[model samples]
Structure formats: C-alpha cells, structure tokens
Target: MELSPRGVNMKRAFIVPAIMVLFFSGCGKDKNEGGKTSPPQAKSESAAKSGGEKAQMPSRLQQAVKEGRISEEQARQIMARRAGGGDKPLVRLGTAARGEIRTHLVLNGTVEPERSVDVYARLSAYVQEVVREEGNRVREKDILARLDDTEIRISHQQAKIQLEQARLTLEEEKNNHQRNQELKENELISDMDFQASEARYRQSRLEFENKTENFKNLELQLNYTRIRAPVSGFVTQRLIEVGDRVTANQHVYTVEDFSPLLIRVFVPAADINKLQAGMNAEISSDTLPGRTFTGHIKLINPRIDVQSGTVKVTIEVNDSSLTLKPGMFVEVNIVTRSREDALVIPRTAVLYQRDQVLVFRFREGKAVAAPVSVGVTEDDRVEIVEGLEEGDTIIIQGAEMLKDGVEVSVLK
Candidate 1:
C-alpha cells in the first residue's frame, strides 16, 4: 500500500491500541471464583450499601450501614467480621441466677478412727458369759460378756482369808509385845528377849501389810469376770466365744466412740478465713445416693497446707441412728458465710479462667469484658462484687467465641 510515514505510524499505533484494549478487557471482569461465589459481589455491594457482607459484620459497621453510610474503618470492620469476627473474645459463661450468696469450700477429705479401742481382758478367766454379739450396741460399764468367776472368786477368798490371818497374827504380836514391855520394866525378862519379841512382831506387821495389798488386788481381779464396755458404741470385734479363755490384756472386743461423728475436709488457703468451727455443712455422697446428711464444723486446723495450699476443716455429724457409718466417701458443703440480699450471678456467667476471673456482659448490643470480684459460688450461682450493674445482660452460651464490639446474634 502506498503510505505516508506519519500515517503508517498512526495506523500502527491504532492497531496497538486496539490490541491493548482487547488484552486488558478481561482484567476488569467480575469473575466467579467458582460460580457459587462472586469476587466482585462482596466488594461491589459494599460500595453502595452500608456493610455489604451478607454473612456478618462488626457492630460499628452494622451501625454505619443502618445509617446508609460507613467510614473506611467501618468497611474494614465489615471485612474483618466476614473473616469470622465476633463480640467478646473467647470466654466461658454460666447462668446469672438470683439467690443467697454463701461462702463455701471445695475440699478432699477422708474418714478416720474415732478413738477405736480393741477391748482387752485384764483378768485371766474362761469366757463364761456371752452378753453382746458382733456389732451389738453397748454402753459404758455395760457388761459385754462374762468370764468364769469361780476361779477368780476362790483366789480372792483365799487372799482375803490370808489377809485376815496376817492381821490377827500381827495383832497378837502387838499384844504380846505390849505385855512383854511391861515384863521388861519389872525385870521379869532379859533385854535381848524383849527386843527379839519386838523384832518378830514388827516383821509380822510388815508381812500383814503386804498380804492386805495382795487381797485387794485379788478382789479387783474377781470383779473383772464381768466384761464391761469402756465407752458406749456399737461393738465391732468380738474375739472370745462363750467358752474361750482370755488372759490379761488379751483382745476381746472392739468399741468405737461415736458420740458425734467427725468429718474432715480440706479448704483452699485463700478462703480459709471464711471457714470456722461450728459452721454448718451438708454432707452427701454417691454411695448414700439421694440422702443429704447435715453436720456441724467441729474443728478448723490452725495450720495451712503448704503443698496443696489448703486448710483442714473438720465437721461432726450425728450418726446415732446408725445410718451413717465411718469411711464412707462423702461430699461436704461447708457454709462459711452467707448473705440474704447479696448481688450474685451465675457461676457459668463468670469464666473460671486461670489466674483471674472474667465475665462478658452485653453493653448496648456489644459484648464487653467485665473483670469481677468473685465471692461465694454455690451451685450455678455466684456473687459478683464488682464490674457489673444489676440486671445486666451477660452472655452465657456464646461468650467463649466472641470478640469485643463484634456483631452478636442474641438468643432472645
């Protein structure tokens, strides 16, 4: 083609523009990343609308969208929300229940021996009596069983006779000495003879004293033929049968002291001040299902546990009806302090976090953190001393997955 240089250049440039236009045309397209989603759908809708993401948006952005316009920060908030943002950072919640606030302690404890004594027979005798069987109830001085008193009584009688004989012999010696002294004064007997009589009489008196002691001891032994309960309680062990012979200090039966049964509990050192002697407790256990036993604090250990950081608290329960036995694993609820009109919330509403306590309250439709001073937490309710007003809306279910100021779908 016949061409001028300038016109040729112009034609080349026009062709290049046409090619560039064709090449760049697809670059601005709203591609379906997959036909299921629109890359521009989210962005384009956001340009004209408040907060364009259909799924989620932050509280500030949601507000702006309601007002028909949003700031750049609001738009950023929408993007962040779309990427899984929520109000109230990951926390836990429980019910904010209204009730009395009572200080309590959670402890691990064990049952112990309450002055258990293995009965021993102090006198040697054949068990001639069977008064109490195993697990039988006995009282102090109550005869548990008896031993053969025939031998004991005979020994006692013999000792008593000997004691009387010794006393009579000593008396006769004294009478003779008195008369002999009178004879010596009259020079009717030699001095050596008088002295000899007196010596003999003194020796007999000493022997008599020894015999008297032996007699009393023997009599006491005779009384031991009747086995008596040292203290009142149910009999646990009975080693002797009806005819079994028992020697001195031999095991016969076992008795337990159960005037008021003792219960031991451990409490945290931080809450030790709340615990006191004579505090009321409610005891329960899996073994004794559906049964709650009431008890009172009998002792509070003066020392704190260094290793476990707990204090030992003891409660005494009345098991006189024989229903509660020793060594049963139980749950003891110790009431240290209580308030009839204390501000309390749900224990679940307050997150039991490590090192501190946290609560998430819905403030003006946004979740905000509320640091709390936790008091008595009984069952599902807890005492909130700080950081919340009465009747505040606290998130119970969704607090664990929320961030501050994020949009929340309240559960009504």
Candidate 2:
C-alpha cells in the first residue's frame, strides 16, 4: 500500500495497455465472425434469386406449348421430367417392331391410250356422207363415212356386162366346138376346121376368166368407197367431213381404245435393273388429286437411251372409269425392294457420325449407342438388319443431343 510515485505510474501504464489490448482483441474476433456469417447470408440470397429466375424462364417444352406446336399433355410430360431436377435427359422413345418395308423407284411418266388406230380413206373419191363424228363410239366394220361411188359403180357395172358377154361367147364356142368334133369324127369336116374350132373355144374360156377377174377387182374398189372402222374404239379425231375431197390412203379419223390406259416412263439406267415386266406400280397425277391408279409393267425397252441415260418402260392401267386421258403427266412408283417380318425402327432414331451408323437405344434409363446395319428404307421406318432386336426401345426425338451412357427420361 505504501509506494513511490514512479511505481504508481508504472503500474497504471501496464493496466491501461492490457485493457486496450483486450478490447481490440474482442473487436477483431467479432469482426471475423461477422465476416464469415455475412458471406453465407449473401450467398443464400443470391442462390434464392437465381432459383426464382430459373423458374420464371420458359423451358423447351413450355416454349413449344406457347407456339401451338405441341399438345398440352405432351408439354406437361416433358416439363414434369425437367421439374424433377435430376441428371436424366429428356428424350422421345420408339420401339423396334416387326413390320414390312418397301423401297420404291419414283419417276415421271405420261399417259396414253392402250390401243390407237388411224383410219384412212381406201378409195380416191369425194366424201359423200359422214355418219360418225369425233368422240363417237364405233365397232368393227361400222361405217364411219361414205365416199362418192358414181365412177366406181359405173366401172363395176361395165365389168359385170363384159363378164356376162364373155360367158355367152364361151358357151356358143363350146357348142360349135362340140359339133365340129362330131363332124370331124364322121369325116365330114377338115382337120384345119377342127383345130380352128378348138382354138376358138380355148380363147373364149381365157376371155371369160379375164373378165371375171376384172369384175372382182371393180367390186372390191366399190366396197372400198365405204369407210369402215378397223377396230372397235372411240373416235378421237376426224379429219374428213361430208363433201370433203379425200384421196386414197389419206388419214380420215383417229380411233383410240381407252379401256386400259398406257403409261410410259423413262427410268434411269441405274434403276432399270430392278424393273421387270409384270411388276406392280402405283400411278398418281397432280391434275387428279386424291386419285391413285393401279397398274403393272407391260414392257421394258432392252436398249438404253444413250443421250438421256434412261430406259423406256410401259405400264398398263385398268381405267374402266375413263378418268385418265392421253397426254396427262403422272408420277409412277415402282416397288424395287421389299421385305416382310423385318425388325424396323423409326428413321429419326438413326444417326450418322462419320462412317458409322448409330442408334441411341434406351437401356436401364440410359442412352446406349448401338451400331446398326440398315436395309430397305420405307416411309418413316427403316429395316434394321443387325444390332437391334424386336421390342427394344430406341430414342427417336432428341437423339441428336444425347451420348452413350447418358441418363434419359423417356416421354411416351
């Protein structure tokens, strides 16, 4: 308790320094704790803000729904998987099934009548009467037109008169020759007279034959004045009219048979080998929408066109309705290859990377890349020859965004 001034001063200084040091140390600890705690609070606020933004932003499925491109049910299913917030990727799946696949060779073609005939005038004369006009249905031997037969009729009559006269002369010569033969046998006629009589009979018989031939020729010419249909068909064109002067062998009418229509197509040389006579084909035209005509290959040209690098093919269509007309442009689809009971998958599931053909198959909720051998492709399905089995599920849509072993949530 009794101390000197120097000692009091020294004690005071030590106590003040210790108190200040304790105060500063407490403040530093409080600052450090606040720093540590405030950061977590700030991080929590930032995380909450980020989550709110993500919820407000539209997902791929939501966007599709807004665009009217997808149904609400489909969009809902897609969004449901995304809302789960997992590592799984959303994908559309299709099942590999047994089906039929057919490959076709498509080409442009033209329609024509199966049978066409050009009727011609057989006699040189004026057209006296036209019984049938264009678009008239005619049968075989049906008279389509008639020619003026005045000159031909007169010639025929003259031939008949000459033939009758020759017949009478032949008969008289035969009777004379018979009497002469009797006289000669009784030694009442000379040998010269008998020879003359025989010569007269032979000449008369030859004359008769010549006249008969002339009469037949004239009769044929007279028949030719009447124009007849060579075939049973509809008259497509008529170039002759009543009182029109026509010459022999001139085209008078054009007749066509349209019961079975013909379609001609030029096929590329590369696909010609796949075609044959009697192969089934489907034909369609833009002019006649929603109509499909069934036909079969009728002919195949053995020679290939060097300039166009194509081969001519003829197809016959049964057009009983007569809806198809000649010169109509049409499209033809010929089945080149076909397979039944084939393991098939959607064409969209196939992926081409470099030289490999791969498909993303679903196995245990993961996408597994499988290399597949492809065969005939028909419509939206492709024949899987290898690396896939029936009933296996494969990714159809959203396959391009997937890789092997990635988790996938399949949408029905």
Task: State the displacement of the C-alpha of residue 96, model 1, in Å, after optimal TM-score superposition.
Answer: 7.1
lDDT of 2 by residue, 62-155 (tens): 6656765456777656655555565666678889999888999998889998799999988789989998988898999999998999999999
Q: Give the number of the best model, judged by TM-score.
A: 2
Error at 93, model 2, angstroms? 2.2
lDDT of 2 at 266: 92
Q: After superposition, how far is residue 20 of candidate 2 from its true place, in Å?
A: 54
46: Cα error in model 2, Å: 25
Q: What local lDDT score does residue 67 receive in model 2, on the 0 to 100 scale?
A: 60
Could you tell me how far off, in angstroms, the CA of residue 83 lies in candidate 2 after the best superposition?
A: 12
Error of 1 at 338 (Å): 3.3
Report the C-alpha lDDT of model 1 over 43-105, residue by residue, as the tens digit.
666664654445466575566556544345646554654455554233223345456777666
